[model samples]
Target: MKRFTLRTGIRWKITIAIAAVGALITLALSLVVHSAARVSMLESARETQLDRVQYISRNAEAGRKPPMGAKLNDPELPQELRDKARSGRRGTYVQEKPRGLPEVWAAVPLGNGQVLSLHSQFRESANMMRDLDRALAIGSLAVVIGGSALGVLIGGQISRRLRQAAAAAGKVALGDPDVRVRDAVGGVVRDETDDLARAVDAMADALQQRLEAERRVTADIAHELRTPVTGLLTAAELLPPGRPTELVRDRAQAMRVLVEDVLEVARLDSASERAELQDVALGEFVARRVSALMPEASVRIVADEIVSTDPRRLERILGNLLANAGRYGKPPVQVDVEGRVVRVRDHGPGFPEALLREGPSRFRTGSTDRAGVGHGLGLTIAEGQARVLGARLTFRNVAGPGGTDREGAAAGAVAVLWLPEHAPTTTGSFPVIGVP
Candidate 1:
């Protein structure tokens, strides 16, 4: 099964969160401001209307002409206000006018059977409220935008630190334990991200130390056993030809192979190991390798491109792969060469999940089906040798439940070795090491 994670970046997530909060706050403030402004403007207009109409009522009571804007029982005045005035109470009403300011009316009883009323459009208060609303809208928009930009700035800093730490961790996983996140980021733990970087750096340091110790131990043990295993093989060969003699020789040979593989693994781990490159016809090379290591395997050449590589190291890698196929996979192993890429496939139950997910691990057969055919160093040795050659090696299940299969072949595991197209500028030579 395959799994995936969301691709959205932390910057976008942070920006969205902050902008949403800012938008909500701005919306709330705008509501409160709009309501407060509307209420205050209406109240002020009502007070002005009431004062003018009352003054006009007093002037008409003395039989003086009212002001121009004031009227005596104007027909256009609201009937509700007129009725209230006739009943000896002051009344006020507001009428909405589309596309313009509101008309405010106030009526007062004159005590002479005539009602006095005054009205005017509240243009100044309306314009003030309109301007206030516009300002609030613009201010809200600005707050949201500014919040988003601030989030981006903050998120970018955090995301960059996290990405660096993650990349360093990935390099460590790929066997480069020297990568230190603290070097890329600051060493000081200023925040959570810095703390993470520090943790990654510490882990890399610890892993590097542990791996170096392990390599030293492995190399020492293998070198110590090499001479004894060689003597044991020689001693077994001198025995009389019998079943017991054959068994002794076979056991000694197995020990020698194991010791040699361990030593080879140690050499591959060293930084001093270098590839001696030369032009090699990939198709012909693969054919020879398959014949020598696994004669039952079939080879197909799609393109006979010449690749510059160390043939000895390439043979070691291919030998391990072929050995693994014969031991753990079913019959009809297939090797295909196309350009600089070589694929080795086997028709058997696909590789275990652990091997597929994490490549090969030392001393781990990865399946109960291994049946003790090897010491579980074949794939690991192959991978290390490939790395020394500056080549890429990948493992996958190309057939069966985990993958698609060839037209008539059963599901199985596939390992691909891809060599660089051209020779490296400098091919440093090291002592030739044989594969077990």
Candidate 2:
């Protein structure tokens, strides 16, 4: 259980707020009621004592003596009362805890040069005040406890609803277009939270629609250009074997590659790609793929763990990563496989800040020195392929050892692929990864 603090959570804040307000109101009411009751009880006791003193004085004038339970010449009489009686006027005084009783004393002057005093024990009124105090205390406590509990309930409901909407928004931000926030507190009780949920759902729907339209446009463009690209390739092949022909052939091949990448991206967007899973030793699979796709790169297998995955999709991901490293990074590109993780490190200027931050976009090359080097679709396709294989792809910059660089700057870029050991069985769809 966490201790409650103002900063702990919205629920605790709400609880404390309600408890504080309730306590203040209870305290105020208790003070008002207690003060009024104490004053009224004390006044009534004094009036009764005064009336008894007057009656006793009247009796003394008629030659009547003190009553059976009355005390004459009481030693506990206050001097103030005696002085008032000596002046031939009625007087009253209160003695707290006199003779084991809280008593109100009143006195009157007798015509025969004597004084008559009457006192009333206020024990019953004192007990009533004490009981009132106890009730007020108990009522204040109940108000605080009940108010706090109610605050927790209301705050928890609001927080839970907000969390649900936030989680759905997170999924949307991560490229999961199918996510929607459920109407937890449905119709007729709607408020701002419901409005926020509705807005988030609408935004996700709009994003999904826009992405679908873009995918359709890409697929259509790629489909329409395939025949023309094939014709260009064939025409270049028929040209005489010369420098001009080689140039034409190279350009044609480049165009073909770009078209293929665009088509693959469209398929990924449309969720048309499917994975074919198989059990394979992670170390061996990585070794084979690196040798075939990037024979020049160094390989180090620290652990051999078998993982259930799609081999072809895995190859596609690794191939693109290796190609990117070879084209843009410095020499000594290294591939390390340990357990279910595969990391490719290149001793080049680490990935550009923008590239690492915003991710790869088609045709936006990160290398300024080698401008127009290659289409930026390599990493984009690799990321999409990794997702299909139920793996995560991440990139970061790694710094070299101390004093290695003259300016002491970062060493290179590192791309990591985390493949889970046990892949869940999917029927016919490629599972979206790196998204919520």
Candidate 3:
């Protein structure tokens, strides 16, 4: 059997804690006040009994006796008080009953060998004490209830503000750079929560400004290099066909490819690229594109589905994935299309741990070869294009039969792309073909 418990949110927990503390303090104060009042009232009753006894003793000494209703010399006097009178010592004692008011007895000795007693019933004082106790009990209960209600109200307000700030932070984490906690939590009275919201807003602003600056610099650099790269390409193409000429042509072509890749990356970073979606059969599109770009790779269409997406961007994403598989992986690169999802699997040693963790970056290579690794812009451009089409791209290392590393671990790299079934299209599409 599972143990039962009371589960509560922060609001209730805070409210209960504050109310409990208030209740304890109120109870302590009430007890102290009640005790002090009881002591003072009891002392006053004792003094009144003492005064009555003194007056009766004086009258007896003047040869007069207490009046009939005074209860002086009553037969019901306690033995302790009677004995003190017989010994000629003045004394007082209290007499108690089970269900009624108590009586105070005072005794004194007469000069003629007789004892005198005086007593007073404490009916009025006992009733007053009972009423006082009732009031204290009711007042203590009221204080506890009122304090708890106030605590709940204050705690609810605080909890609501905190939840608003948390939601804004969640949106910020999900790439909504414009989300701000200040709008939700800001108020005229500045508090710690407001300070936290302001700090979050300031951090987001700084991050956005830095990113914009970096994008502008990248775009400007790419634009300046394009002219010189074009001239170099033309000169290399005009050279005579020879060993040295071939080397120059190849190097110039590589440089041109790099320049174009940089321009494409800059365009993506600046959000200048848009998708031009069209209704197309996904299976036929994948087959034709794979045949045209990577004829050596095997293609399998599991279940076809009509999807609305940018055909050119789709081709770029698939082409880059295929090229990376062929470059870094063994033969038999497999392309599988199921519904709106595509899976490209390469039976290689799998992606390096760093590449999987950090995604892709320009000019960073993960190939084991020390030389001739292409600038690492293929996956970077592919991922950026996927984002433009509102698609998701994920990479993982899967276990494959007979494919193992030197340590005898089976592994292969799998890149999966998921396109939305009904993607919205715009007027323009970004072309990423031949980008390095």
Candidate 4:
């Protein structure tokens, strides 16, 4: 196994720095004490040597200096004492005579100036210095090791909390919006994590509100539209045969038209509708519908327009425009299509100015002639379908083509559908239709 090393964070590193400094200071203090103690012991030993020499001088003859000048650093001493005197003890030192060890002579001084003395023993200063060094080394090492351990423990605690916060943030990024850091261990990240959680919660609440609103609207359309349709079916079943088949047929046809138009509008408003788009050359598509419905109405495909849409739905929208036009416009009803745009302008009295901005509204009549024949749902349904197909249905009162008698007071109604220029789709042409 590898040896463990201490690592620290910002806060703990500062603590460790302080601890290390304290350890160093403690070691320095120990060295100071060791030095002082050694100095004091040497001073005491020196005083003892002087006292011994003075006592010997008073008792016997002596000189101003010792006969040997200084024999404490004698090479013939024990190996341990020899190294200590030169390397450990740097100042004045004294050696004591060992009894019965050779002819060792004790130091004694003459009264005036002559000196006589010889000593052979070990230096105590050497032993004291070694003891001080050993004790200091052990104490200093313990202090440093303990301080470093504490610093690492503090750093580890901070690192763990930071890692937890990062893990929670990562989970949120992976689409687990519900994930969040716990609030129990409050710190710098507390406010920030709380803010993030609240933001996600708010987003979820908004999504649910939007979904509920859509469901409610769908339910409302189903309830309102189904009642009229049921009554119309029953009324049709009770219609007695004969009595001018024309009137009966027209009446039944009128009811059918109203029901179909309302249902188309409802489908457009339904959130579940998805338009199956396809590549369509709009020129041929519009021309076919126009020719089939109004062969003698002088229909014209004015441009080689192209788009992606439900061709059947487009036909229905144009069929509604043509029916409105044929009922109210001049004999030659006109149909024109441009690039991604289908325009049907009639040569009859124009639509009522009041309903121009209302685009597709229920029972909004554009004329009085067709009032009894059908409710004003034709334009509304067409506009709704055009929107669902990713397009806009616009109404405008404009002069007839060439602005001449062909208009024949033919300023009836002009409806234009601007379709989305979708990219080419792989689906087949003329798929099942859906309102926009």
Candidate 5:
């Protein structure tokens, strides 16, 4: 089963933030401006209407007909303004009609139990406001859109530079010595992203230099030890046969193996090692190797698919695993081959916490309260060889009735080797077998 997630990139996040802020600001300003404009326009209309009502009052006092749009004691005048006129106080009101322009009214007392009132529908102010509202709305939208576009431009540059730095770091981790981060503006170093790029490039350079020095020292030590170790082996062989002679031979052999392992590590570190690929019956190959290493171990062939890989490297990996299990792990060791995968298990204390977490490191044997521990080169060599074969090697502890708890030793350790299925292979399948 697979799960998928929707990942929102930094560019979109920044754009949305900027657009939202811009929209809020624009809305606030639009409301303020519209309120101020409407108030100013209505106030001006009220002043003009008051002047007309005063003129009509003077005309009635002079015994002449009132002007158009003006009436003495009009029935349609708003009650609030009419009450103010009856109390001898001038008043003004703005009426919002359902259709047409808004009506502005002004009233004055005539002192004869009558009132002079004038009204006008201020169409110019209403139309001006309608036009202003349209302009503000369009302007607000444009601001938000423009801000979003600017945000994308800036955010995209940052995101792209970060992706480049991340990709370069990944290649460096995968043992690519020549990868370097490139800044957005080539050599400018303009911003934090540029700084990050420069920092990554510097780190990669330092790492490559350190690794080269380490490999040189390892190769030098191994080459220096080869001659004397070989001479010592020859001398031990020529000595008289006894318990003392056997001890000398064994120690000398161990030293020779150590030197050879160091040399192999140097080669793998140099990144120039190549695999010799050939088709192999996986089950038969594994069976033979297992028999040679630990005759008492069991082998189970489940799929037995023929695979293409380097036989020498494959055998080296398996041999190291078998030797490690037999030395430190309690047996009933088992090897299971299924398709392009091989799993080796030992019913012993599982690998130490450090080993499982950090994988194998040269000369660092993660031994606990177990029987014995090796020099730690075996698993390291095995892992390097798997890399050369383009395969994945992983370690785990199997849980079951026999498995140990945290306070106790683990039940068993399992090492899995997953071979590449896309490798070229020959035509036939190998027979499955369960050997005890």
Candidate 6:
């Protein structure tokens, strides 16, 4: 599946969102840490300086300079501060202003009214604050980067599923009625993905059913129109002996037949999902069928079998085969029924290889003779009926008198019709309807 490009996907959107949020949190944390760490360090520095002054105050002589004097020099001061010891009103004040240092001034009073002062340039506190700020910034950045990566990955997953759903939809739109998306989670996902997959499947199935229904309706309408036209033609032929009327009647009859054939195909193509369940007898059924086909035609039936089927539909199937046999056979249609197998052999030349290969497709007349012959749909209807009945109809080219390549330069096809085994317990009664 094709995923969104880097420039388009949710990965970056999520990453940006993560970074923004993480940055805010990290910034606040960094500031707090910087402030706390710097203040604590400064406090410690001040306490150490005060202790030095206290030591000097205890040892200092009333009239002489304190021994702690040298320790107050720039190198030894809290932050390399410059200083000089002098007594102040509260104590001895230490004064200094070392370049580039934070100022610190302090004094300790003596018991004899003298004092010690600790003063220095700007130093300690500023350095501690700077280091703390740097640490917080680094830590916050690391966290933001990690959060962004996670967010982008999550967004990519969501987008990928969505893309698959989109692809499935496209296929459905293009007439791929079987297109369906699998749920990322079992039993219909709890989210949009589940909804999308279900919707796609539902759409494809509904569309397929609708198309099938329309095809069937069209075919049924055509098939139903046939009888009336055929009747009308027969009535017209009886009315007059004129060539004009005869030609008109014949044309009308032919059109009616054509219309009927078209409709029959439509019906077969459009039949419901499955056929009606009913039992039919195949052996006696074949004998009666062959007998009815051509009177005095050499149609023989050796065995009688029975099977479950739609009687009306089954009649249509067998009638088509018998009619074709009578039309093309040289002498008489031969009908052989043994159990579930019904074989009708005719003296007609076998079908060509090409026709056999095409099998029982619609409109395959196998002959180009444009005479009174019906153009290919009867067999198509037969095939469709057989399919609906759960039976098999196969067409093969059989040799004539000389076992030569009848399929290559032969006349017609040898069609075999097979049904399931359904034997009647009694010869006179209709076989039991169907298998339990």
Score each candidate by Cα lDDT. 0.83, 0.83, 0.81, 0.61, 0.87, 0.63
- Candidate 6 regions off by >4 Å? 1-239, 273-280, 369-372, 400-412, 421-436
User: Model 6: per-residue lDDT, tens digit, 1-436?
Assistant: 9987656666678778889999998888877787787657656666666676666656564455566342322344332122223333222223344655554455554555433556544365676677767777778878998998888877776677777777867765644444576533234325667776787677678877887787767666776777787777878877767888878887897788689677767655544435565566666666676567555545455665557766676778778876776665444556667767766665566543455677655555665431145576767788877766667888775554555553335444567877754422322123568668
User: What are the TM-scores, per candidate, against the unseen true structure?
Assistant: 0.84, 0.84, 0.68, 0.42, 0.82, 0.45
Clashing pairs in 2: none
TM-score of 5: 0.82
lDDT of 4 by residue, 1-436 (tens): 9999976565577557867796878878997988798667656765665566455445444333333434433445444434433352312244344552122223332434334333433356657777888888888878777777776676666666656656765554433434555542246644454565556556655654675566467556656766775676677667777666557566656655565565566565543355667678888887777889888766566678667787777888889888877875555577777777778876666766556756656666654643444467777778766755757888877665655244234356678888866532332112345789
Best-matching candidate per lDDT: 5
Please give the range of 10 consecutive residues that has the lowest summed lDDT in model 6.
79-88
| lDDT digits (tens) for residues 356-414 of candidate 3 | 78888888877563115888888899998998897889888876565434432436688
lDDT (tens digit, per residue) of candidate 5 on 149-199: 999987887777777778877877878666667632353447777777778
- Evaluated against the true structure, the overall lDDT of model 5 is 0.87
Alpha-carbon runs more than 4 Å astray in model 4: 1-240, 244-250, 366-373, 399-410, 423-436
| Cα distance off (Å), candidate 1, residue 226 | 2.0
lDDT of the structure predicted as candidate 1: 0.83
Error of 3 at 164 (Å): 4.2
* lDDT of candidate 2 over 10-37, digit per residue (tens): 7788888999999999999999999999
lDDT leaderboard ranking: 5, 1, 2, 3, 6, 4
Please give the lDDT score at residue 355 for candidate 3: 78
lDDT of 3 at 335: 97
* Superposed model 3: Cα runs more than 4 Å off: 1-13, 30-181, 184-189, 299-303, 367-372, 399-410, 420-436
